[model samples]
Target: MPIYDYRCLECKKRFDVFMTYAEYGNKTVVCKHCNSTKVTRKIGRIRIAKSEESRLENFSDPSSLEGLEDDPVALGKMMRKMSGELGEEMPEEFDEVVNRLEAGQSPDDIEKDMPELGDDLSTGGMGGMGGGLDEDF
Candidate 1:
């Protein structure tokens, strides 16, 4: 199926019509706004789709981090792209971190304000029991 864009010469209104291969040439196109038959078909731009593997590979490339260290907003957007490529549901804290980064906050400042978001705290170092899970359970 292909979508065709048309602009009515009478009302000067533009609209889109989705048509199949069989009906593409046989049917008459009409303007949706004014029901005008004097419409001109337009050439629309084509779209391309990329594979998930290609998107993930782009995310993993080191070049993706270029200039990110100095730009907090770019770093946040990069983190979003990374999460999208991984196809996993990021935690709520991850969104907060990204939001703060986009708001021009440094990672060190964010860590100081929210210590639970620290690297060591992400593991079993902070809230977990004194002993390993295996020893308790």
Candidate 2:
């Protein structure tokens, strides 16, 4: 079910109703105030609003990265913004990587020592491994 917004022409009452997508545009919306059936469909703000998932998807699209390699600052800022929004603290390894890159250190000099952080369950690492087979059987 999708939420549809409608405005009453007679009373100018705006309201949301949950209905199927097919029925949304065709359904007659009535005003709650004066019981007027003359209602108009309002353009929803969400129609153009990109969700967090959609934004992430857009960023990850390879086709969108045409000339991003030439701008290192932009890349760093984007990474930092993504990290902040994702509630992920930059690992010490990442700090080292950034520092090394800034200090003219080669990619080979930057050792990968990313320590696993945070609750494993919350991070969705290892889960659903076992069952109470002894008790059930």
Candidate 3:
């Protein structure tokens, strides 16, 4: 589900709604304060934060990662298992970070000095997964 921004042409009121992709396009989103059908779609903010457990769960499961894991040791092993299943080589940096992790170094500690190591640390490292927002949340 995603939060969508909408503006009511009748009332000139802007509001947000939480709904599935299908519902977003098909449903008639009316203004909460004023019931109006003349709504226009607008881009809404996306929440990207994942809890610690959610992060771990994503790392542990190959299915969720589309098999991008390809390290023989540490998280790389898990990634490799996933990659083998998905038939793709995990990103080179992913394997490097797994090597560091296997050496018993904390990701935070490594990330402090080498920011690049933190690239794909969360989810598939698509970039900017944390909850903190640039604008006021």
Which candidate comes out best when scored by lDDT?
1
Pairs that collide in candidate 1 are none
State the displacement of the C-alpha of residue 112, model 3, in Å, after optimal TM-score superposition: 55
lDDT per residue (tens digit) for residues 1-137 in model 3: 78877778887667889999777567877888788777888653334465656545544754554423242235545544444444334443555566676665665665776675455444344233232322421
State the weakest 10-residue window (summed lDDT) of model 1.
128-137
RMSD of each: 14.3, 17.8, 15.3
Full-model lDDT, candidate 2 = 0.54
lDDT of 1 by residue, 57-136 (tens): 88677787788878888998888777666555555467778889989998778889888756445565323312222342
- Residue-level error in angstroms, candidate 2, position 121: 51
lDDT, candidate 2, 20-54, per-residue tens: 97886687778777889988777643223546786
Score each candidate by Cα lDDT.
0.74, 0.54, 0.57
Off by over 4 Å in 2: 46-137
The TM-score, computed over Cα atoms with residue i paired to residue i, of candidate 2 is 0.32
Kindly give the stretch of ten consecutive residues in candidate 3 with the minimal lDDT sum: 128-137
- List the candidate 3 regions with Cα displacement exceeding 4 Å: 44-137
